[model samples]
Target: MKKIEAIIRQETLDDLKDAMLNTFEENPIGMTVTQVLGFGHQKGLKDYVRGQEVITSFVPKIKVGFVLEDKCVEQMIDLIVKTCQTGNVGDGKIFVYPVEEAVRIRTGERGESAI
Candidate 1:
């Protein structure tokens, strides 16, 4: 199985969730949301009118995650890219990794079945 993690603009969370729900069967997928802060090459610097320092600090972002079959990876990535794109900075990023194993808490089922 593959674990897909996407860090995206918080503003796009609702739309992304709605799209995923529509695309997949109910209960076949799981999702998580977490608040995050970070900056890229642009950094947190911003120009000021009076030459005063404006500390942007960390920018707010949302982290979304789920487990899916290998076949579903590309589709999921496409959906996220399409839904999250705004042609602007801080659009966020996506990461994928192989899950060593998964186990169901109640039934103790393992592997892809556990997911």
Candidate 2:
């Protein structure tokens, strides 16, 4: 198993979800979506507050993550890039990690079946 995590622009969440749901038709995909604050080269944005300029160093982003079979990792990465890329600096990042194991609490299922 592998874990794929993507930090993406907030506006692209819906499109990413639709693409993943449509492409993975054979099996239901389980995922977690979290609202997060982060910064890259873009370094957040400048805004006016109370007639003063303010730089918010942490920008709002969406973190989408899931654990799935190793065979599907590349496919998911492609889908994420295709669905989220905007040719902009703050588009966000994708990270893949090795998963040691997985367990389903209700059924005591382990390994890929548990995923």
Candidate 3:
């Protein structure tokens, strides 16, 4: 199993979700979305605070997390990049990690089935 985490522009969440659901309709794809503040190469955005120009170090982003079978990882990444890419900085990043285990609290299901 793998855990895929994608940090994307706040505006792209709906399109990404719709695309993922349409492409993976054969199986249940559970995902978690979180509002986060982060900065990378772009540093941050310029804003006027009391008429003074300022660069806020942290910018708002949407972090979407998913745990799925290994077979789905590549396709998921592709969809994320395709849906979120805007030919601009702060479009965000995607990460994949090995999942040690997964468990369903209600039914006691484990492994891939639990996911």
Top-lDDT candidate index: 3
TM-score versus the correct structure, for each prediction: 0.88, 0.95, 0.95
Candidate 2 Cα outliers beyond 4 Å, as residue runs: none
Between prediction 2 and prediction 3, the one with superior lDDT is 3
In candidate 3, stretches whose alpha carbon ends up further than 4 angstroms from where it belongs are none
Model 2 clash pairs? Answer: none
On a 0 to 100 scale, what is the lDDT of residue 53 in model 2? 98
Instruction: List the candidates ranked by lDDT, beginning with the highest.
Output: 3, 2, 1
Give the per-residue lDDT of model 3 (tens digit) for 15-46.
Answer: 99999999999896998999999999989999
Name the TM-score of candidate 2.
Answer: 0.95
lDDT of 3 at 106: 100
Candidate 1 or 3, higher lDDT? 3
> Which residue pairs show collisions in model 1?
none
Cα lDDT of model 2 by residue, 25-89, tens digit: 88877989999998989988999999999999999999999898988999999999999999989
Task: Mark the 10 consecutive residues where model 1 has the least summed lDDT.
Answer: 40-49
